[model samples]
Target: MDLILDFFLVSGIVIIAIILLQLFKVKHKELPQKVLIVLFLLLFFVAIHFYALLHNIIWLIHLCFLPNDITTTILGPLLFLYVKTLFLKEDGLVKNTLGHFIPAFLFALGITIPTMLFNIFKIDTLAYTHTNFIRTIIRFESLYFTLYLFISLQLLSRYRKLSKQKYSNLTQYDFNWIKIMFLSALFIMSIDIGIKLYESFWGDLSWNADYISVLCMIVLVSFLGYYGVNQSKVLLPSFLLNKEKALNIEKTKDKTLSPNKKEEFETLKHKLEQVLHTDRPYLDEDLTLGKLAQQVSTKDKILSTLLNQYLNTTFYDLINKYRVDAVKEKINLDSYKNYSLFGIACECGFKSRTSFNRIFKKHTGFSPSEFKNNTL
Candidate 1:
């Protein structure tokens, strides 16, 4: 038994040590608050469970006095925080102050109060004495565990809802690893709580071993490093949202168009250039393939094909290139020098200062004002 406990115990500690080292690697990167929270929960679990391993070594008893309820109480809420941190937009609902921690605080207090009270009065019964206070604590443990389950369910449902809606602006979030970590922890905690509840009712400690809990703790601690090592944090840009991207390759793909359709496409493309040079497409943020296709008397598929093959860019980029060109021309004009660069971009059909600046910088490597100043 000691040999088994020692093997699992050392393995758990080594895994956590690796995770701690991995955190330093991504210290410069943007870590969402929920990821940070998961990191701390893992650290806490390791610290307590490591002590359990120490106690097992010294006392020749597995699981020592370090109860499973400590980590079992925390797994769900930490996962709930993870969901909020990943997919939420600006100033989301999860951004409350310390009040949000009341549930966790109360649970921690439940554990501390019992142990502290036991120590203060030398009430050996929580360990040796079978008392009402211990029973009450177990009951509250079940209630909080249930609350955590419900919260996790809500987070999962909300994640599905937001993902299905396909919000174009916030597609950058990819919490796939964190999602797996949360689910795994949730599974372990559910079983841990079930055991606690059964023990509280029947006074049987079936399947409650310190070694098993310690093994799971090691796996949970690896969550921080696992995602960082395997994945990238590059966010999805606004232009790529819900839009099919053109494949990049040396060989041109077969267009599958007939002789009559080919002539019609060339004619329409020429007319589109003429109309766009006259009126411009950059002025409208909602300018899409369908809209462009209609103005030129062609279908969306034909226009999309042209944009994909000839331009070697998405429809969004193709339009933005023209917008940038127009912005530069306006900036060069001496008459427009009297107005702000933003005003110049507005006249060139840019809807917002931010869009104008972003698209211009993407192409020109300079902001609108910066480019204007340099040209002037």
Candidate 2:
């Protein structure tokens, strides 16, 4: 048991060090900046948690600085915001999002005010944890953690739905690993709740369950660190590009298309199709609406509008339609006849067999192998 505690403590410090190193050295700006903030907060929280469990060390730190449990209040908001910032185009700390961090602010105040008074009067902090105020704060933090975790799950679900609606190659953006991380959090929370309830009813268990919880948290933080560092940066959906412009265009479309504007739209449509045919950008699995717009020499809004309003499809469908056609064309050729269906899919810019099979079937109303066999 002591060995397990030592393992968690060592692991927590090591992970925090690695996270700090990555934050300083990595220079790419493809992902949102807020992601690093969330990762840092999570790693810091876990490290502090394990630090507090070590005997003598915890007392020394507590004696110097007030013990804080604000990390509990902040973790949920950080996770929810991380998902939002990753998927959305705008920076996450807009006025609308200010409310998300209110709990953290409140918890910090709860801790700081009391600790300041204690320090001012030179009062001992030994019995602070037993106070009703502290107990109430702890309860609220636990309740809020559960609530915020569910909200994070909802954010992930919403991101998934939007991604499927707008992007073809979801391998990078799916964030399935995040779902696993959330479930792990919930598991830890359940164990924590159970431990608290047992302590309340019976008494403290002989084995220190809080240490076990901290160990679980260290593992969870390790997973969070791994995923945060490796996860691919997200591309904003095309429809979300210049949202004000989209809204204005949507409102006016109900009235009429002016002659010049209609002509421009036609030109844009021709250019879009020409680029799709000539350049074959869909063969690049990481192709995005913005990238396609650049290739076609059109604005993202105009290109997305062309696909959404004119063609009545999404960027995902339009691109995957091309990919599906490319695969069909390849499968029909004598050169690809001996190749595996998955190999043909990979050659045709399908990132995974699952996405390829799904998209291919959606477009042609038949699986790749079925289509090939029927044609043969």
Candidate 3:
């Protein structure tokens, strides 16, 4: 058990050091990167706190203990803010999110500082007085962190749904890594809470259950550092960012098209189809609803409505359908017979082989290679 804890402590230090070094080398760090740097710094302190505890380093434990306790509040909010920064392009991100850290600040100022000062000055009276109250507050830390994790997951779900409407290729915008990390954190937190509950009711277990939670935390921090470095800004449009408006637009019930409106829809739809067939705009690979709307000489909202209500499909599905058809046509042609499946998919605006194979299977109920072989 001691060896395992030592391994985790050393691994945490090494991973955080590497991440911080890479982040510091960046000339101009974005908000997400800045948040990650702060988050990892806190995790580094956490690693030190555990290491100090393990080795019975009295001074080091005294130094890190209170700060580590405070970080339980701050770390969750930092991760929530990181997800927010990635999805939303807003001014004054730091200024606006200052409120999220107030709990941590108050805990530090009211609880941590006073407690630390009491210990340092050997003020037995004050330390004894605040002991129970401090324990009560610390008991709620897991719940607080769990709430932030839930909120982060909610924000990620909303942004992912909206992203499918705006962009055809969601490879960069899908924050799946963040989702997995949050879910894993929640799972680990649940186990830790359960262990604590058992310890409270029954006598202390032989083995240290905290080792499980701390080791999992170190692993999670390493996971976040790996993906968080490469994460790109989503840059959703103003329309998609307005939650009330977007919800209303997406959830509105379909109604029968009026004669004049139907005529207008038909005219725009005809033009849209003509342009798609002739111009082959879906071949851009980075095609978006707004760009397609521009080619059809219609507003994006109108195009979105046409696709959603009139056509009964999403912009993503429609675009992929066209690309799939194009690939099928090319596969049937004698001249293109020698082209690799992925090579053909690339020419048809599919970004990668994985996506191409998945989408091709979805559309035609056959893998790309299977479809090509059957065609031959």
Q: What are the candidates' C-alpha RMSDs?
A: 15.5, 4.8, 2.5
lDDT of 2 at 105: 84
**In candidate 1, which residue pairs get closer than 3 Å at backbone N, Cα or C atoms, i.e. clash?**
125-129
Candidate 3: Cα lDDT at 331: 85
- Per-model tally of clashing residue pairs: 1, 0, 0
Find the candidate with the highest TM-score and give its number: 3
Q: What TM-score goes with each of the models?
A: 0.49, 0.74, 0.90
Give the better candidate number (1 or 2) by lDDT: 2
Q: lDDT: which candidate is best?
A: 3
Model 3 C-alpha lDDT per residue in residues 27-113, reported as the tens digit of each score: 989888888888888888888988998898979878887768688789888888898888777688778889999999998887777
Looking at candidate 2, what is the lDDT of residue 131?
76
Residue 123 of model 2 has an lDDT of 67
Q: Give the residue spans of candidate 3 off by over 4 A.
A: 128-133, 203-208, 250-263
lDDT of 2 by residue, 100-217 (tens): 8886887666675566556456567634845765765675566688788999998788667556444668876758888998988888888788777777677768866666666677
lDDT of 1 by residue, 166-277 (tens): 2211222345555576567567667667776676688866443444555675776666556644343332222223234323322343455567766766787788888788
Residue pairs that clash (backbone atoms under 3 angstroms), model 3: none
